[model samples]
Target: MIKLKELSRLYNINKTIVEYGLIELLPRQHRPFSYTLMRIVLFWVRTKHQHLSLPERLRLSLQSLGPIYIKLGQMLSTRRDLLPPIYADQLAYLQDNVPPFCGELAIKQIESSLGKTIDELFENFDATALASASIAQVHTATLREDNREVVIKVIRPEIEKTIQADIQLMKWLAQLMQRFLKDSERLRPVEVVYEYEKTIIDELDLMREGANAIQLRRNFLGSKLLYVPEIYSDYCTKNVLVMERIYGIPVSDIDALEAQGTDLKLLAERGVETFFTQVFRDSFFHADMHPGNVFVSYDHPEDPLWIGIDCGIVGTLNNEDKRYLAENFLAFFNRDYRQVAQLHIDSGWVPEDTPLEEFEFAIRAVCEPIFEKPLSEISFAAVLINLFNTARRYNMKVQPQLVLLQKTLLYIEGLGRQLYPQLDLWDTAKPFLEDWMKEQVSPTNLLKKLQQKAPFWLEKLPDLPELVYHNLASGKSLQKQQKQLIVSITKQQQKNSKSYFYIGIAATLTLVSTLAYLQTDKNLAMIAGIPGLFAWFLAWRHTNNE
Candidate 1:
């Protein structure tokens, strides 16, 4: 049963959907009803924003629907292939630019979370926000004890309750969609919401985000390609996080970078290299690399290093996924479309029943046009979209685990193009992929794998002989038991056969009794009926005993 608050939420959601003209997206059976009801409500509650484009309306609807819907829009923004360009473009605004809450409330929440007064905590704390996003806002501050420069990230006041309400509503909506919408399984709306729910709920804990930042910082320690800020653990909490403030040009600020005499081309290449290294080498990456979260170091004017922030959402791949991803990238670079198709089948990304030759052809057709020009001219996101579009026909399943990586790639490519439009991603990524592939098959890697497993093998070594003997004993016992079981099954089968014979005889006698009665032989009919009823009872008793 829905609560009163949830009902109210649903009413608002319906009104918003109706006002935004999204009723058209409703399933065929629901559209007419929703349209009529929404119009009736609209007469009382006027919408002044009717002049907005459909995409803009959608963006506003998601925004009005609250954080959960905004997050959904942000995720959808990455899938240009699945959505119209205008929608994707408009939805991109939800990434880090959502309207911030009041600074006074932020201070109160921070004080409450850390259990310290503002004056006691920071010698110089800026009430004005440095940046605001969906979950939290950051403010510049200096520690009172050491006067260390840092940024205080505070979760929005009472956000948890709002988030819970919106999330429950989304789950309800997803359920409705799956239950009523046509071909809804293809969308997997519930699964998508579940994924988003986990991601967002995880983000609600600033401590986890701080930990993600620390891990990423350690992963790229002493590396020139990327930089992660130091997290101040003592000042961090579930709702409030304090980290060393980072000063660098935002990655999207191309003109500012040019003004600083930054190496734009090198910057673009390093962005690609950083992504591949984070994915292939470490298997851990800062998944949310949108322009707002990425910055370029001013120190490395010649090298153009990257500084990553907001590690709330990170992505990691298992060993198998990493290996397959590396192989796929290498094959793609080499134009081995057949290998790509085979790898998909081997990885169970596509059905085993998919025709390899046809899949190869489809992949080739999608990829061939993109490679005709230099890598600099080709769009990495566009290539991925085309491949996905083609693969949809083959019933390729969505890998929800890779959704973060896909979003990261869009961010990286968009950043790369802004830094240097002529950036050759293939040129930057191919060598790294080749080296990774070589490492996978190397003797050293095999030795490492063996060494990693050596401890487990050693632990089991003493039990091996006993294990073998027990196995042999169990096998012998199993054979004897199997023979006995087979005999028992045979006896049961024989009994069932006898029961079935009785049932057949009963059915035949009943039919004969009916025919005799119809032919006016009453005595014969009575005799036949009595025997039929007796047989039926006997069969029933026999069947019950068996």
Candidate 2:
């Protein structure tokens, strides 16, 4: 059940929703044209909602909500498969670059959480935040213990209240979708929201984010593609976190990066590589890879290091999903549209009845147009958007992780475009995917899996002869039963066939007799004559043949 307060807020939002002429965006089965007509009238009544495009309306609504809604909007922005290209582009701007709370509040929160004063915790702490966001804000600081420069991230005060309220709204909307939307079961909106709810709620507690960061850092501790900041344990608290900070250029600042003589091409390629490596190898990725959350190390301009901040939203894929995704990427790169469509069906992205050839043609229709275009000219995001829209015609189920992955991919592509337009994602990603697939299917992997099951196999070996004897005996019994069953089925089928033949013969005889008698009658003199008799012979021949 939804709270009255939350319901009222939705009603107010619905007011704007009506004015925007967007109630049609909702699933049609729910409204019966009532909602559509009402929204059209509302649009005429309010000018603020009347003139905006679809993307602008989405942006405005997200902005009106709190951080949780901002996060939700950001998530939605990644789904090119579900939304319009324009909407995805506009929602990408919902990074929520708000002003941070006062430094005094930051210090107080830290002191309260750590049971120590700020003076004892750090030698130097900046008052102004480097950047503030929906969940937390960051400030640069230096630890007195080791004279190490670090950044302090503190969760917002009273964030839970707002987040919980917004989550309630999301849950309400999801329930509505599950209730009225066509194929609501496939959409699984409620489950997606629940999954997101778990992640964002965990993010509210900085300790969980810290643990996720530490695990991720350990995964790529010595690796080259990206860096996860070190979490300071002693000073860490529920709402406050201390982590080692390094100087690097933000990934978004294209001009600054170019001016610093950074190898934009190499950086962009490595960015793609880093993403695949994290997703495939580590299975834990720094999900939030926006410009503000990432930076480049200037120490090596030719090979810039990625410095990842903000571990609030991370993604993990089960081995099955990972393997399917890798295969999909490989298939896409190979321009195997049929395999892509089949993969969707096999992976259950689309319904089982989705015709493979039709889906293949649809995929090719979207992909064939941009086959040889340079990566810069072809918008990867747009291609995905088109592909997704096409799939909706077949009622394709959206992959939640793919949505996250797509968002990150767009993030990567957008960053690449900003940095180096000529960077080819396929070229960069193809080799990585190939190598990863090789590792995944290597003999070593097989051996390792078998090795884990070796003990069980060894124990079962001694009983093998007995097991085989039992199997042989059972097989003989099953064979006898099968033969008897076959005989029964054959006899029954023969009976059915003979019965059908007799029925056909009887019907034919009846028809011929009726025609012959009618031909003699004055009423059928012209219609039923020698032609009817000849037709009767032909019908008899046809029935007799059966």
- Candidate number with greatest TM-score: 1
Task: Please list the residue runs of candidate 1 whose C-alpha ends up more than 4 Å from where it truly belongs after superposition.
Answer: 1-7, 13-37, 49-65, 69-97, 486-546
Worst 10 residues of 1 by lDDT: 74-83
Query: Please, what's the RMSD in Å of model 2?
Result: 9.1
TM-score of each: 0.82, 0.74
lDDT on C-alpha atoms for all candidate structures: 0.86, 0.78
Q: Taking the tens digit of each residue's C-alpha lDDT, what string does model 1 give over 7-69?
A: 788788878876677765667786676568768866776665778887888888998787777
Q: Which candidate's lDDT is highest? A: 1
- For candidate 2, lDDT tens digit of each residue in 194-297? 87788778888888888988988898888777888889887787899889887888776678888989998888888888888889987887777776678899
Clashing pairs in 1: none
Instruction: Give the worst 10-residue stretch by lDDT in candidate 2.
Output: 522-531
The TM-score between candidate 2 and the true structure equals: 0.74
348: Cα error in model 1, Å: 2.7
| Candidate 2: segments with Cα more than 4 A from true spot | 11-64, 72-96, 451-546
Query: Which TM-score value belongs to model 1?
Result: 0.82
